[model samples]
Target: MRTGFFTHADCSRHEMGGWHPECPERLQAIQDQLIASRIDPFLQHREAPPASLEDIGRVHTQSAIARIRDHIPSPSEHYYSLDGDTFLNPFSWDAALHAAGAAIAATDAVVKGELANAFCAVRPPGHHATPTESMGFCLFNNVAIAARRALDVHGLERVAIVDFDVHHGNGTEAAFVGEDRVLMVSFFQHPFYPYSGTSDIGAHAVNVSVPAYSGGDQVRQLVTQNWLPALHAHRPQMIFVSAGFDAHREDDMGQLGLVEADYAWLTQQIMTIADQYAQGRIVSSLEGGYNLSALGRSVAAHLKVLAGLD
Candidate 1:
């Protein structure tokens, strides 16, 4: 089985604005680097299907879904602001659906053994959208939805969510804080945007709050000393990753110092855990990588490891 690569054209059409860092060009950059790195052909590509309201409602509130569905702007209108940073254009709704659908589809494919694992390269990057609200450029919580799907639909007893974004995945934590069936392990830069992972996270979560300018060595240590022990103890039946590359030194979105090699190492470590307990089933979704060049290179490195090309 190969690594499935899931995406959708609607994702590119969901732009916030010309000045936004989370532009359509982010997907193009990943594609460009995958082709340039010659890793594109190794991936089994799949166009994402739009997620149903039922699928979305598993992780989000009905009111939140209604709000997003009702607020989509007409083509004549450029955007509708959900918050200061998140906005909706005419295509934003479909894009958000497909972005989330990519994660769900990838989860299904991996769970069914159609693929060894999968990477969802779609966006309006999630991880910031909570159950009752959409914020930080996210319309839906993609990874959270995927994790829920793995448990509720597939009957998985144990699952893990790993987030290495620069900012805390406050939304994801909120979704599965005390759920014994889920174990969420993550390391995020502290005192950052959507800042809420530092205190009183439940027993089901192991959240490491690191300082800005922290390097790969620190992350590796944290993963080994913190994430790995908890992951092994949990023995997750499947693993879902909220893969974010903005921690790269070149990405101005945050001040962490991770590089491409660090990303490859991180994927390898996660793969090790998945192999041991999850039968190598992993579903990863894109989140928060801004620097075009760095994002491209970092995603390639991460995918190379997932595809066993590294």
Candidate 2:
């Protein structure tokens, strides 16, 4: 079976600014690389529909949703800031909706046997946005929202979210903190932006925050000593990943110093868990990565694993 690729044209319409790293071109870069590398041939494509208000409300408050909508500017005008680094342009809302919708729909497809697995390649890279705090170039917590929908709406128990974004997914961790049903395992740069996710949160949140320049070996050691044991013990019913490539040595977003091999191995480990416990059910969404070619190559590497072509 083919892995599903979910995205929308509207995702390309939102632009934060002229030189922002989190630009619409990120999506195009992934698509172009996939095409150029013949990686798209291994995946099935689907156009993501706009997410409903209820979908957004799954991980964001009603007031937060209203706040995001209240700031949409006229096409003639352009940009606004939700916070210091997170900016919005004329089409930001619609792009965010589709970015979120891609995850939701991909989750539905995988859980319903419509696809083997799915990858959402939409942007505005969500992982930093908390339920109440819209920061870190993210407006909505896309993977968190999808995981909740899969659990509550689809009646699945024991869902796990594994975030490998170079930066700590403070938002995802915050949303699922102290919740037994959902387990969030994250490895990120410590003392970084937002800088939260250090100690264990109750028992459900497993975070390993190390210093800058910790490379692939460090990631492997930490996962072996920490994540693997916990993951195998939990044996999750479904798996969701916040796949961020900023950890790559080439990307300056963070200083984790990981590469494509690290991503591939980590993905393979998750796939092994999915095969054993979750019936190979997994859903992943792109989170962060600034350098264009690095993002493309790393995404290709990641998706190759998702498709089991590696």
Candidate 3:
């Protein structure tokens, strides 16, 4: 089985504004890089289906779902603000559904042995939206939704969520705070946006917050010391990754100094863990990455590892 790459055209239709960093072009950048690196042909590409509300409901409240469904802007309105950063355009609802759906479908494929692993390239990136609220340029927590599907529907005894985004995946953490079946490990820049991971997250979570300007070596050290041990002990039946590349040194979105090599190394580490304990099952979804050039290159590097091209 090949590495599955899931995405949808609808994802390109959801855009905040011309000025926003989380633009539709983010998806295009990823696609362009995959082609440039000659990795596109090696992937098993699939068009993402829209997620059923039931699938979404596993991780989100009905009211929260209603808020997004109830408030989609008409064509003439152009945009409706959900928060300072999050907005809903006419196509946003469909795009969000597909973004989340890509994660779910990918998870299903990986769990069922139809593919070696999968990567979701849809957006408005998730991981910041909690169960009750959609914030931080997110309408639904895609990774969280995928994790829940692995647990509830697939009946997996242990699953792990690995987040390497520059920002803390507070929403993903919130979804499985006390749930023993799910173990989430992440590293984010300290004193940053949404600023919530510093406190005691939960017994099942290993959140490492690094200071600004931290480099790849520091991150690797922390992962070796912290994330690896927890992941080994968890012995997960499957793995979910909130793959975000904004930590790249070139990305202006955050201050951490990770490069494309760092992302490739990180993916290798996660893949090693997946192979050892999870039958090489992994479903990774795009979470954050703003700088177009860097995001493209970083994703390509990550995919190289996932595809075993590296």
Query: RMSD in angstroms, all models?
Result: 0.6, 0.9, 0.6
Off by over 4 Å in 3: none
Against the hidden true structure, what lDDT does model 1 obtain?
0.94
TM-scores of the models, in the order given:
0.99, 0.98, 0.99
Worst 10 residues of 2 by lDDT: 194-203
Candidate 2 TM-score, true structure as reference: 0.98
Return the lDDT, model 2, position 79.
79
Clash pairs for candidate 3:
none
Least well predicted 10-residue stretch by lDDT in candidate 3 = 196-205
**Candidate 2 residues 260-280, lDDT tens each?**
888999999999988999999
| Candidate models: Cα lDDT each | 0.94, 0.89, 0.94
Residues 109-186 of candidate 1: C-alpha lDDT, one tens digit per residue: 999999999999998998999999999989999999999998999999999999999989989988887799999888
Which lDDT value does model 3 have at 119? 96
Instruction: List the candidates ranked by lDDT, beginning with the highest.
Output: 3, 1, 2
